[model samples]
Target: MAPGTILLVDDEENILQSLSRALKLEGYKVETSQNGSDALNLLKNQPIELMMIDVKMPQMNGLEVLSQAIKMHPDLPVIMMSGHGTIETAVKATRLGAYDFVEKPLTTEKLLLTIDNALRFKKLQDENKDLKDQIRERFHMIGKSKCMLELYDKILKIAPTSGRVFIFGENGTGKELVARAIHNNSTRKNRLFCKINCAAVPKELIESELFGHEKGSFTGASKTRKGKFEIADQGTLFLDEIGDMHLEMQAKLLRVLQEGEFERVGSSETTRIDVRIIVATNKNIRQEIEKGNFREDLYYRLNVIPFIVPSLRDHADDVPLLVEHFLKIVTSENGKQPMVASDKAIEILKQYQWPGNIRELKNIIERIVILFDSPNIDENHIIQVLPLDGHIKKTRFEGKKPLRDILRDVEKEVILLQLQRNNWHISQTAKDLALERSHLYKKMKQYNIDRGNNSY
Candidate 1:
């Protein structure tokens, strides 16, 4: 490592020579100046890590020089030296950002220790800043709730290993965010983090998408293409909506998980790869397996490490923090002034059920922030901006209907509203209502809603 540079400023020639020799002998690059003006001038051109300045000087005094040096190099540590140093003077120097103050006839050992501590503090500050930047760049998991803290702790513990994580949550509950967090904090952070939406791909193309395809494999196959598994080799492959995958695809995926080898479509050549798999689904995999929609073997293999993400409704206490975070993000992006929510608005938000979880809350906050003209968002503003169902008008009557029936009615209404808003696209509507597609289909059938006429 390169030696740390130290600048010593004093009006006395003997003091400068003695300190310079001592510091040089201690393996530090030393520079000396007789006055504050010379020290400031040298500071502009020299890369000094620390400065020791005398409080009493002829031209520019030590305090003024310390102030100027801090403005030029904020991270540089300044230690004040004074023969007639008073308590008030030391306090004032500290207020002006001096790292430390030493009285006249300073002991070399104490001075060296102070310098070493200052350098270490600076290094720690730099490292913390870097970590914050990296966190901002990757996941937007915005929450300060106890649940979020626990989730963060889990990520720290599991990210360093080659564990196959099964993330379970409601739709839009940030399963992908959890997966990405694991990948970002893992040993393969530098490699690709690929995602495949199992429900979005057609049944016929699912095999080609997962295990690659040779040239002329099908009508549109003009050239060889790598699948998500190969693309995410040595990294993380996130299988989202895994419960929606076809039965045949599940069998093929099971084989890959068991053997770690696969043959491309229309090709006999088998390839092997080492991949860390992370599967996420809103659907209950055990239930799906019981229903014969999902493979039991695959479910067992992927359920090695299960992480359950809490819904926004479960952590209602964090709504205000999440609202503030979303408001700031939206206002900054739109170049608008900051806005605050009124107490009534907060109460209204807390009263409503957030079926869509964090993603829904974020979208609703952004919508309100963009449309409302008032600086203070009140209950009226929230009522007008959000959809009608956001504010429930009826209270439960136990004697009139069964609790389960009433709950089903409420769920059916919320699902219908979300379906209408999303133009009845099953996948999108399911996401907006925080339900799996199969679950939504079953609910629609139960409610006698026609999917053909309401199709997106």
Candidate 2:
């Protein structure tokens, strides 16, 4: 596909033909107009990536078009050209957001260079804007409850500091989101916010993953690698599920926290890094330390500034806001029109024990938005969409076709919920459910329970 469309406006037909041919040959889509009125019409009708307007045009000069275009498309890049160019006119065009001013004897090389630079600048502006939006969306703590307000106060107090934070909550209570909120609001916001799951990485590889590896470090180590600590240097490193890390890895991690240095795997040289540490776990730190699953020293080191994300039940009043927020996002992403959840539906959503917390709520909302095509979401629709927890066991029996069919659905849902709670770790899920790995695999296949790219 062409990179972008460039609109060329000039009273001179020769200039229009020449520029259009040049831009198109360079793999750009080009549109041409001989008058400012036609150029304005095209700008209003179609998306133009970059526009070149002749300043000395008949009927509505480039300056006038540029001024009006700024109101219509504030971010659009427009370059002005004039054979009768002047310092005053150039200054005026620049003030009106013209990308650049060019003389009418437009050099192909100079014009192309200006266009390239302007486009690149605009792209950077757009990317920065997008990053800001994502930061806002990812860290938005959607609640106005007193507890949430208190949590926000704490986040605002600690985010700008260089303190290490230890966040604890039940699974899916938005620990990761809390970590991101800290990073997004911190002094290191412009730098990287690297994350790694202590439970996700293999026991043997967790060290190399944190401290990096030299070429030929171990089996399949074909290239030198920079670990999360190095990549997140001068930024933040989030250690998720920190309680699940092996005891041996805990010692090495403690050393990094104390000394801020570690040698790469299979390399003698040590490297020092500056990273703000943020660790999170669903496990109780004191209990884990007593049981020898986690290190007491490491626990103390990470708990410099502790944060406990509130469970969804603790702030049930936020359900309406969260429902609205997720519904808007879900529908817009799915190319659907806005849908409103009834007030009673919101009240019913508040009555649930959200064991899986915000993540679970988001998944439930996404499923409902996709499955239910109706514009209005009522209590009946919500009761059907909510999880079949033991609280609503009778609801599951409603309108059942057959006893065997209901058992199959219950089996599938129970297994799926277990897998989701365990983050889709098949072995652990099977072990917890008291099933052999082989049996678990057979059942999963029978029920079409695919872990890959499947959301709970």
Candidate 3:
């Protein structure tokens, strides 16, 4: 295969021929353009990795072509060459975004070296851009609603401290994401982030999982093991589903929280740890404490820094963004081309109650990408997946409410549905709903709708 594609642009035929031979000899595919105008045409029509344009050309100068090309592909690499080279010309080329400046009477060796350097720099730039994109995907929270913005502010505030945090949310509301954001922003980001699901582990083995156990401590204890606390020493430990931890284990955990130390299952050797604990639970801790299933003292300690991750329904305006993000990720991971979610499909999604939250949204996207053959996922696809018995439409006619109250609910539903379908464009929504813009704004405030985000 050719090393890369290069476009050689110069008014001189002899210079073009020599340069083309040199590049092709080094296994590079070369395209020749006699003038800067043709060079710009090639750049717009095909993929050219690097371009070498003579500083002095007819109709269009090298600097003019460089400026236009950079505007089209800001990351592209371009070099300028001149036989009548001067210091002023080199500086002008640099300001015009030329990758390098090469004097005419080009030596084969020097020419190849400049090309190699330009390609290497471009590759490095592309790699850095991809790395930044991946970091954003991993750490950036995905919602733009009022609640999510508040949650982001809280994470930023708590991330630098060593305070114990208690995150409360419904299932699949991205609580783990909050915990990760906290750890990623903290000083101990380079250290371990240990997590264990309290509800998933058996009751008898929970202690061994949290605090280490010695060899032969129990029937299945074949070897000495380090628990999550030890592994996460000087790091962050995420306790998922903290409400399911046994009442007996809660006391032991409380002792560790208070003393910053714990003993192995079979050994009296106490180990001290400097772990920042961030625990999450879908259940209400107060209710758990009232039932005598959780320690009130432990609850108070963990609740020092409280966070609530809003459910998907609470921020329905964010549904379109979440849907598009999830679809791109799912389709790419499965080695398939990305599919589009139509506006009507997004409206249907925004109407959903999403008991399972973001997790359910992701699953639904992946399923559609796998099962549907069409590139455009429409409202019918969403309707097929969503449950028929839902609350939004169901709550409208409940309890034989008064006529005025029923009309208010109906108006709120109609306005919200229109706003969502328009991706929160206020003027367009009002026009589509046949309401004046001022009246629409008044109704939005009366219904307490804050059109703060989701501008698409």
Candidate 4:
């Protein structure tokens, strides 16, 4: 490993030479500066891990230098040294964010110990800032709709705790996105965030996938394998499409939730873990329990805190923002100059029923960016590229309709498209349309759309 870089600042040439030699001998990279300004300039040009500065210096005092250094690199640790050291000066240095102070006559052992502790603290702060940046990039949850604002508020409030989050939404409605937001905002953000698609795994393999498998446990089990639970210890584990999990697996899952312990496949030994569980399902788990497809106990265990992700159609006001964001991403990826969609094109997009929610919208924008060469893409360009299906038919009113009536028609069409995409699950349909279950039911009644209870 590379040695940690230390910037030593002192006006006394003899002291600088002596300390530089001793730190170098102790396996640290050292740089010397006679004055505060030169040290600040060096810090700007190069990455300085730590700074050791004499308290009394010409031109700029050591405390002023320390304050400026912190402004530039808050995580950088600075150790103040003084021959005329006093308790008041040490207290002042500490208040100014100095890591620690040393007497002028420094012993090699004492100096090395202080440097080690300061470097360790700086490393921890850097790691924490990097993790925060990663979370912001990955789980953006971009939107400004009223419903989106509410969801954001809920996530901020619940993320600090270890509460189990149950996300309810339709396929492609960004359920996984919400789960990630919670994980990234939680206290265990630095730890692993493991995910498993319960619906994607085969019924027989789910146990092995969640609780690891011993050697010779199954057909392909040549070696012992760690499972999602073990990998996510001290972090968060996201279980996607949980409502589709097999009834038998649900029983095992309930047991694990009740007691944070599970035995690996084909092994008698039990392992315990500390993991926060977050589950997402595009199905109505309550209805599944009623239909004997899900366990009541498991449902309750996972539903400690419920979060519903609204689909693109439900938040029509955000369509313009999403369109711009997609345009930026697609244009950058294609290495082309950015393009803008015309107002007419945006209006057409807002009116259309997004069957596949935000995912479909993203794909459509990418296709348009690649195929069309126009600077200003209009409604005609959109119509040409969009898939030809029952959802995109043009309509003309025989007579002038009220604005409210027109909007209601648009809402009805969008809801219908999402219902078809989600196979008519009311809970999933509501999430896709950004509506509450109660609100969707009222709208269904108003629109005279007859969906039987057996749709799920």
Best by lDDT: 3
Which 10 successive residues of model 1 have the least lDDT summed? 389-398
Task: Give each model a TM-score.
Answer: 0.58, 0.64, 0.60, 0.66
Candidate 1 lDDT:
0.85
Residues 1-456, candidate 3: write the lDDT tens digits.
238999999999988999999899999999999987888999999999999988888788888988998999999999989989999989988987999998879899999999999999999998988986696595567888998899888999989999999999999999999998999889998787889999999999999999989999999899999999999999999999999999999999999999999998999998999999999999988988899999999999899899989988889899888888888888888888879999978887787778788898888898888888788998657655655445255446779799899988777866766675565789998998899999999989888886553221
Question: CA lDDT of 249 in candidate 2?
Answer: 93
Tens-place lDDT digits, model 1, residues 13-61: 9999888887898899999999888898999998888899999999889
Tens-place lDDT digits, model 4, residues 197-219: 99899988999999999999889
**lDDT sort, best first:** 3, 2, 4, 1
298: Cα error in model 2, Å: 0.9
Minimal lDDT window, size 10, model 2: 387-396
In order of listing, the candidates' clash counts read 0, 0, 0, 1
lDDT at position 402, candidate 2 = 91
lDDT of 2 by residue, 1-456 (tens): 236899998889999999888887788999999987888889999999889989887788888988888888989999999998899999999999998998978777887888998899889889988978876785677999999999989999999999999999999888888898899899998899999999999999999899999999899999999999999999999999999999999999999999989999999998999999999999888998888788899888999999999998898889899989999889988998899988767866786778888888889889888888998987656656666463223445679479998889778867876776576789998998999999999999999898653322
TM-score of model 1 vs. true structure: 0.58
- For model 2 the TM-score comes to 0.64
Score residue 189 of candidate 1 by CA lDDT.
85
Which candidate leads the pack in TM-score?
A: 4
After TM-score superposition, the amount by which residue 128's alpha carbon in candidate 2 deviates from its true location, in angstroms, is 4.3
Error of 1 at 206 (Å): 1.8
Error of 3 at 422 (Å): 27
Better model by TM-score: candidate 2 vs candidate 4: 4
